[model samples]
Target: MSTFFRSSLRSFATTAKSAHHNNHRDNHKFLPPTSFLGSWEAPKDPKEAEAKLAQLRRDYAKQVKELRKEYIEEMELMRLEKQRKDEARREALRVATEERKRLKAQEAEIRAQQRNIEQQQFRETLLKERAEKLEYWRRKVKMHEEKKAEKNELLRRQSSMWVDEAEIEKQILDTVIATTHF
Candidate 1:
């Protein structure tokens, strides 16, 4: 029973395939299009079919070898490109580090120069103040000496103007006694 059923199904599929092809042939009336289903039928000449299958296998193997070689070459190129990019990145970082060091040194030098200038200015200012103080003390000492000398000169003049009244009266008595004796 199963064999009978399968045979009928196969005949029905063949009839359907023939009908479909007939319909397209009647419409276009050209050669049928190549398809997987159409190519699935066994060839009438077994030797020719085997030769075609062997040729197809050879072509497929050649295409696969070519694709694999291309893939390996592409991978090598990608690796070289990655290495170049890495080197570029390292060079940029090195340059940036050197620039930072240079800027830091320049800033330190500027700060040192500013400190020296400030110290020099402070020393000059201190010297100027000391000189002014010495001048003021010298003027004060000279004024004091001048005042003391003026006071001593006034005392000498007053003593020289003074006279003795007792000496003058004795001189007058002696002169009168001498005239009476004459």
Candidate 2:
């Protein structure tokens, strides 16, 4: 594993050196003034190399720490955003459900009112019909009573006429008998 890591690092260094050389060749005239002069030299001794490696390690550690902090902060921000969106969605759904229920309740109330109105109208219609029927029956009864009164008056007149005729006949018979006896 150590040999593999060393080989990989060597390959990365060779690639980075070739890329740098290519860029330097491509834009030689646009190079910075500082690039004209070499600022640092390679360490010679083992102690110097060790010190440089230690410094590089320290710098790498600081960069990794900063990167980790930034990554953690970004992840936390994303989580908070997701939570806020979820809460907003939940609230929206709750409001929609409540609105639907309110509308349904209002519809039910309207239907109830309509039913009440219909029932009242039906009752009124029935009352009016009953009143009309009662009036018709009263008129019929009055007509029947008038007819009965007229029949009774006719019967009474006929009976009185018969009595008067019988009295007249008896007087006439008595007169004839008196004349015969004389």
Q: List residue ranges in candidate 1 displaced over 4 A.
A: 1-62, 141-182
Top candidate by TM-score: 2
What is candidate 1's lDDT per residue for 7-75, written digit by digit as tens?
999999999999999998888866677664455556789998898788778977999999999999999
Which residue ranges in model 2 land beyond 4 Å of their true spot? Answer: 1-41, 164-182
lDDT of 2 by residue, 26-99 (tens): 88776458842574467899899889779878977999999999999999999999999999999999999999
User: 32 in model 1: Cα distance from truth in Å?
Assistant: 19
Cα-lDDT of candidate 1: 0.86
Best by lDDT: 2
**Model 2, C-alpha of 50: deviation from truth (Å):** 2.9
Worst 10 residues of 1 by lDDT: 34-43
- Determine which window of 10 residues in candidate 2 has minimal summed lDDT: 31-40
